[model samples]
Target: MVDLRRARTTPTDRPSDASGKGTRDYRHSWIVRGHWRNQYYRSRGDHRPIWIADHLAGPGDKPLIGGERVNVLRR
Candidate 1:
């Protein structure tokens, strides 16, 4: 998995997946490891969550984000 804990800087574009899939987010999440927690901001009864990518059967199979793969295509 990508190391988002090192995401002290905001990224304008996302990095490529091992399969070449690209991630998208106006605002990206941090902490690729550690707690598997994400950083999100909410406003006026609305909520927006930042996300990360993890392989289900891969080494990091915690699935804390579950199904919310690409923040854009995720629901």
Candidate 2:
């Protein structure tokens, strides 16, 4: 289970460059054992509290999303 959250130290800058991954790279990421959710909050250099996912790894009967795919990322 990959969980993505907004980075506390970096702010999204939409007007600076053409590449869109600036926000993605700085954003916090976590992989644990259910569902993926997106959210944001105000921060001032502090550790964000993370919760353990109960159903992180998808059910064995189906192929998991984002399990394996080449990510053509740009800097």
Candidate 3:
């Protein structure tokens, strides 16, 4: 038996402006947290499960609602 424990990961901080006021743009936008996934690939005429690295999604902008945050987890 294998103990498939998921690693805990958090979204990296958004980039800040020159004034150091944090990442707050006029346009409403938000950053999607990065996460891991299991993908299947063909290897030697067989399918193998591969672990994909985490990747950030969406533009780095403030959320539409105030104090909104997004968290993603492996499925």
Candidate 4:
């Protein structure tokens, strides 16, 4: 889950402005991995092809299903 609460500038995370008006939002939900070569993917037991990336996927992360493989189809 992304931390949407107020942030404090310290030695670690830096603020975007001098007054610290904006902080880095480290929270991530999901994103498509790799190129959008295909439109849908599905693993075993899935009723339908997953049109979107995995919910657990994040930035710089690859979309994976059951820690195995993903079947993609060209749109």
Candidate 5:
């Protein structure tokens, strides 16, 4: 069971430099056990509850349906 709500925090700038992750380091990541892949999120800093998907990792099997907002579907 992957904890989609659990976020891993890193320095916001770590992704932008030579590391090449470029903004990707600051975002949070979630792994789907069933899909065997990862999902990512970035901070909107809108002072509201929102999460932006950094990028989609898999096919239809893994998708962040709502842009900037992750809707976790539980079956």
Candidate 6:
């Protein structure tokens, strides 16, 4: 069995310059969804399933396009 969920969602930013300052360019950015994976471990002759969370992949600086959705986690 595999279970996946969104861990967190955040806006992406441009790469920082030498001065450690980055521009807020959302035009070229896109949203990347998160997911989970399973890990098997052998302990005492038992296979344990470990759920690994994944981080959002992509430059989320750009605003969401039409019909695009993102799962935001509230603190």
The model with the greatest TM-score is 3
With candidate 4 superimposed using the best TM-score fit, by how many Å does residue 20's alpha carbon deviate from the native? 2.1
Each model's total of backbone clashes: 0, 3, 0, 1, 3, 3
Tens-digit lDDT string for candidate 1 (1-75): 343555488755779778987764333323343234445455545555555564333234333333444544433
lDDT of 2 by residue, 1-75 (tens): 465997677544544547644433222333354444443446745555555465534345554454554566565
lDDT of 1: 0.47
By TM-score, the better pick of 3 and 4 is 3
User: Where does candidate 1 stray beyond 4 Å?
Assistant: 1-13, 26-75
lDDT string for model 4 (1-75, tens) is 333876765665565788857665545445435432333335654354334443355444444334456566664
User: Per-residue lDDT tens digits of candidate 6, residues 1-75?
Assistant: 445998896747557778887764445434344544455555665555555553443466545444556567665
TM-score of 5: 0.17
Q: Where's the lowest-lDDT run of ten residues in candidate 5? A: 25-34
Instruction: Give the Å shift of residue 17 in candidate 4.
Output: 0.9
Which lDDT value does model 3 have at 11?
A: 38
Tens-place lDDT per residue, model 5, 1-75, is 577675788665553566665544213334333322333334643344344445544344443333354678898
Query: What tens-digit string does per-residue lDDT give for candidate 3 at 14-48?
Result: 67789976674455554344555555554766555
Every candidate's lDDT: 0.47, 0.48, 0.55, 0.49, 0.46, 0.54
